[model samples]
Target: MRKALLALAITGVALLGTATPALAHNVLISSDPADSASLATGPAKVTLTFDQYVQDADVNQIAVTGPDGNQWAEGPVTVENNVISAPLRPLGPAGKYTVGYRILSADGHPVSGEIPFTLTKAGTGTPAKVDAAKASGAPAADASATSSPSGSTGIPIWVWIAGAVVLLAIGLTVALRTGREPSQEKTKQ
Candidate 1:
């Protein structure tokens, strides 16, 4: 019985360790224009704030899509601590805009979401210039596109938890079975 209890305790500790990383994925705490906000004029930039640190990597991306489906975000996305920001070209339309972002969480997972905001009035800003290669119909290769489907770090959180559970269950079952043998021998004696 004591051996079984010890095995169970070890399993519990392993399970707890495996579960912590699952909770570490970054969540968007706030944004510059704010989600579903209606603005009188377009801002020159869009910023997103998260609940945890974000990995500052080239794989991070933010795309501001206009009502016309034009990509309005200019240059590369920048990350500083928990905040990520991207420059915006002058916005020209007077409708809804969607800010789509895929950021690398500090735990190495990719967190993606879209924030929608309405433009009450259009600004005189134009979309950023496209690269000559892209303008000429060549597809641009990017880190996000080339990345493995599992993510940057490859191993997912669920896999770790599942492995831990399986190992714990096997060990606990063996421990309980072996513990019963000693009690049975004592009774026979």
Candidate 2:
């Protein structure tokens, strides 16, 4: 019984150690415009780089709000490995413009933050027309309804947990059976 318990405990510790790295979340390492930068003209597109790969999901969003509180990001956000980018319309009205984003991380959780930059000079650009639903504060419709469902590239954490349970069960069973065999031999002798 003691041997079986010991085997189970060792297996549990090993599984816990192995899962530590998989649970880490991605961290933003840098951005194209740089946070709080003063720009003479706005960038054509904004790019965010992370320490780990960004999940490719339809839920990823980047909203560039100009100094006038109007949306400037155009088209859809794109993800390529650790980098995520979104196109922008020409920037208008100089002042502080904020680039806000929410993205699905590689580990399957949503991460969000904002970057602010100052537009030193005004440009000839207009804000994208905001959808009535978005302007009204309603949840935007799922943009990738027809596309394939999004998920992690790795084997899911649940699978790992299930596997650990199976391993522990097997180890305990073997340890218990082996421990009994020696006692039975002594009784026969």
Over 36-129, each residue of candidate 1 has an lDDT whose tens digit, in order, gives: 9999989889999999999988777777778876667876678999999987888988999888777888888877778889999988877655
Q: Candidate 1 — which residues are off by over 4 angstroms?
A: 130-149, 152-154, 157-189
- Give the Cα lDDT of each candidate: 0.77, 0.77
TM-score of 2: 0.72
List ranges where model 2 is wrong by over 4 Å: 1-6, 132-171, 178-181, 184-189
What C-alpha RMSD separates each model from the true structure? 4.9, 5.7
lDDT of 1 at 97: 88
